[model samples]
Target: MKKACFCGTFDPVTQGHLDLIQRATRLFDEVVVVIGVNSDKHTMFPLDQRKKWLEESLKDLCHVTVQARAGLATEICKEIKANVLIRGVRNGVDLEYEKNMAAMNHLLDPSIETVILLASEDKMHCSSSNVREFLRYNRDVSQMVPACVAKDLKEGGKA
Candidate 1:
């Protein structure tokens, strides 16, 4: 079966991320959503917490699964036997950035292909950073993130 890996920090999975994963599922038999941790960046939530949030947010998606990972994304893709690397892009800048990364990913593993999915216009501006900032100021992010994540952020009272 054809499989794809959608890797991201998903500090909090935004609606845009979900849009991409949902769209990807239509094209691939299964999609493994990878919550990758970049040591250089400070994450708002822990890996386990992020994993749980993702699991909760994506529970309804039958062909999707979540995994908390650290290290090279290509390595994770290989481990999962994902033939495609899925990424969500919002605009020109995002497109350019993803394109470069796709090239690098190809250099790392020629067998794996990169697919760029554009975020819906409504959710194009929503991002994990935006969610963190909204929560940091106690703004309602119910519209930006999944209901489960919004609830967690409100209850946890953390950014």
Candidate 2:
């Protein structure tokens, strides 16, 4: 089984993320969407809430599963027995950042290979940080995020 792991904070999974995961599903037998828990960083959404939103957004992807872990992504990949790491690159900056991270991950676990996928033209501009900022100002993020997440953000009255 070729299992790939896509790890991110996913404070609120955006359309770009969904697009990448959906594409990954076709390449790997199973794709594990691991939500990295970083206590040092101030996240807009709670871990459980983020996990729930991801689950709701990706429920239709039968081969994908969501998990929460507090550690290096490489470690999580080892725990899940995933040999591939899926990353989405939006532009040159993202590519540089992901390249460095991939090098570090390779050093930690050479067994796991990192696969970088370019963002689709339509969703290239959608990012979780931008969506969070929009929600903070009570702006509409329905176009950037999944419907379930947009509904939750609206109902939660984030400001």
Candidate 3:
């Protein structure tokens, strides 16, 4: 079976990320959604909470698996026997960076391929940062994310 790995910080799982995963799932037999475990950047939702949120978000997607990435995603992909690295790009800047990374991954492991999936129109402007900012100011961000997550943020009163 063909396997792919989609890596991201997913500070909070947004509809954008979900959309990408859903699209990627169609092409690969299985997709591994990797949430990067780098804590240098202060995130509103930590790894464990984010993992729980992602699990809930992806409950219905049987072929799509979720995992926490401790370091390099390519390393995880190699370990998991994934030949494709999936990434979602919104615009030119994203494409440029991904292109560079793709080349580096090829150099590191020539067998691994990088796949770039563009975000859908509805998800184009949505991001984890935007969601967090909206919640930080007590704005309505439910429409951009899962209902359960919205309630979690609201009930936790973290915003």
Candidate 4:
């Protein structure tokens, strides 16, 4: 069974993230959405809340599952036995950053290929950080994120 892993903080899972996750499902038999926790960085949302948002956004996907971990993405990929690691590139900068990460992942596990999917033009500008910025000022982010996430941001308050 070919399995792919999509790892990200997914602090507030954006539409762009969903687009990639949904697309990955078509190519891989199973897509594991791993939410990586970085202790060095400050996350706007709690790990549980982030996981919940991902679950709600991806509940309809049968071949996809969500998990939370605090370690290198390559390690998580190894644990899940993923043959591929899926990443979404929104722009040139993102591509460069992802390229470096992909190289590192390759060093850690040469068997797990890193696949980068360019985001659709409409969703390219959407990101979890940008969505958080919009919400910080009380702006509507329904277009950048899923309806459930938007509702959660409004009701859940900063997490």
Per-prediction backbone clash count: 0, 0, 0, 0
Q: Over the stretch 73-142, how does candidate 2's per-residue lDDT look in tens digits? A: 8899999999999999999999999999999999999999999999999998899988888877878999
Evaluate all candidate structures by whole-model CA lDDT and list the values in order.
0.88, 0.92, 0.87, 0.89
Q: Write the per-residue lDDT of candidate 4 for residues 54-140, one digit (tens) a residue.
A: 999999998999998878888888888888999999899999999999999899989889999999899998998998788788788
Better of 2 and 3 by TM-score: 2
Question: What's the candidate order when arranged by decreasing TM-score?
Answer: 2, 4, 1, 3
Better of 3 and 4 by lDDT: 4
> Candidate 3, clashing residue pairs?
none
lDDT of 1 at 31: 96
C-alpha TM-score for every candidate: 0.95, 0.97, 0.93, 0.95
Which regions of candidate 1 are displaced past 4 Å?
A: none
After superposing candidate 4 on the true structure, give the runs of residues whose Cα lies further than 4 Å from its correct spot: 157-159
* lDDT for predicted candidate 1 compared with the true structure: 0.88
Provide the lowest-lDDT 10-residue window in model 1.
Answer: 150-159
How well does candidate 1 score on lDDT at residue 147? 83
Candidate 3: how large is its RMSD?
1.4
Model 1 agreement with the true structure over 9-128: per-residue lDDT tens digits? 998889888888888989999999998878898998888888988898789998899987787878899999999999889999999999999999899999999988889999997899
Best by TM-score: 2
What lDDT would candidate 4 get against the real structure? 0.89
Question: Model 3: residues >4 Å from true position, as ranges?
Answer: none
